[model samples]
Target: MSDSKKADQKKAIVFLCDGTEEMEFTITVDVLRRAKVDVTVVGVNIAKEFALCSRGVKITPDEKFSESLSSGNYDAVVIPGGNGTASILGDHEGAKKLILEFYESKKIVAFICAGTLVAEKAGIPHKHTVTSYPAFKSELEKVYNYSEDRVVVDENVITSRGPGTTFLFALTIVEKLLNVKTVNSLKNEMLTCSSL
Candidate 1:
């Protein structure tokens, strides 16, 4: 990558924990990278080296959660949900801290599936409209205005449903960080529906 190109590239940090939904994590990363975003996958677990997904797929993150938090250059912070992903991330003070930092800094804070609960756990002030897995809609409604849209964006915060909505969630991130032009190009090449 050329120096100028690297300088212009948007960056995102994605958090991954044991039992994370594999498709949510994989599709988000793939879509972001396809849009030329520099994505750093962070393993937020004791293992530090790898995390076993809900489907038994093992993924090695690009960095450890502890080390990745200090960098404020990222354009977005993403969290993917699974069966127990919310429980795991909710208990981690570091995860909460990171989300708060990014959100308060006005950077994009995106979460999908049960991951939406993680943001609520981080103490985001209520009343911002958002969405999540149907199972978590009530819980999130307590803090957010709650939308049924496949992908909801309120200011710099973005939330979506489950694995089925991951592609749209990621494409939304690309739109926010890059442009509609980039997203349109990717959608055409990737053959995704023009839902955006």
Candidate 2:
């Protein structure tokens, strides 16, 4: 590939990590980075080591939230679900501000399971179609008027149920950001469920 083409192909994906689900965070990062997308794990705290997932997995963050993350630096932001992650996201002022800014900029913002609550709390409209963890249905129904389903893709936002839906959620984002052909190829190579 030409130099300019290579540069244009580069995309930075940030995962806002605060003890997210081990499966959701790792699977999405592993899949996207395997596709050669630049993936960064941003720590919501000041620690330089790693955050322990609910499942006892450890993830080292590339940068801290104290560092500014302008939308220009990344093509998308992903939030993985874990009660700790969701509660931190909901309570952290800076994290909430950044999420809202990213949404307002119309960049790709994705959340899975309880992570959708972070987006919803950021005031992004759920509109006609949306979904979340079945347990969150009561809260979601109270906040956003939308039809619930197994997975919900509204414009640039993608959401799914939980760890069981992690692969589908990642593939959906890949399909949306990359392409259906690429998504299919990845699925075939990995023997993952086809998103048809």
Candidate 3:
């Protein structure tokens, strides 16, 4: 590939903090890459090279969060849920800023399961539709329009319930970054049960 062509390639990053949900994280990454998005799985905690997912899966990331954030060239960032999300994203100013920057720039910012709370903490508007684990449904209803539909996309933000909805959530993202045509083709190729 030519240098400019490489530079123009669509890029995405999946942020990995310690104890991220393994299934959601990997499914999102796998699907996005299948759609031909140049994906970089970045370890959010710069001090670590690997994130031990909540299911005890160790993921070595492709880049450090510091580098990805400072570079500021990705098309989007994906966040997967786990108990660690609150401490890693909800409480951390860097994570909040990174997400806010993406949203403010009109870039896609997607979350699944409890990761929706991170989007909320990062200032996702309350009017945008979203969904999360049922345990958070009540609180989420008070903030944003709650949807029981497996995947919810409102504005540039996409969210879903949990692991069961991972593929749908990922396909929704691919639709946004690329198009319905691409996602539909991908779905047929993957034999997914549904479409966006």
Candidate 3, residues 1-196, lDDT tens digits: the string is 6888788777887888888898999989988988888998877763467888888888899876672473268888788888786458788777788888888888999989989989888888887999998998888898888999899888889999999999999998998888889898888988888744
lDDT (Cα, tens digit) per residue for candidate 1, span 1-196: 9999999989999888899999999999999999989999988773647898999899989977784574388889998998667888899898898888889988999989999998888877686888999998888787679999999999998999998989899999999999999999999999998875
Q: Which 10 residues in a row give candidate 1 its minimum summed lDDT?
A: 63-72
Error of 3 at 12 (Å): 1.1
Per-model C-alpha RMSD: 1.4, 2.0, 2.0
- Model 2 has how many clashing residue pairs? 0
TM-score of each: 0.95, 0.90, 0.91
Using lDDT as the measure, the top candidate is 1
Q: How would you encode candidate 2's per-residue C-alpha lDDT over 1-196 as one tens digit per residue?
A: 6787777663654555546788988888877876767787777852447887787787788777764667676777888898878888878877777777777787778888888888877777757356788888788887776445656887877778888888888887777778888788888888996543
Off by over 4 Å in 2: 10-12, 16-18, 46-48, 126-128
Ten-residue segment with the worst summed lDDT in candidate 3?
63-72
Ranking by TM-score: 1, 3, 2
Which lDDT value does model 3 have at 178? 86
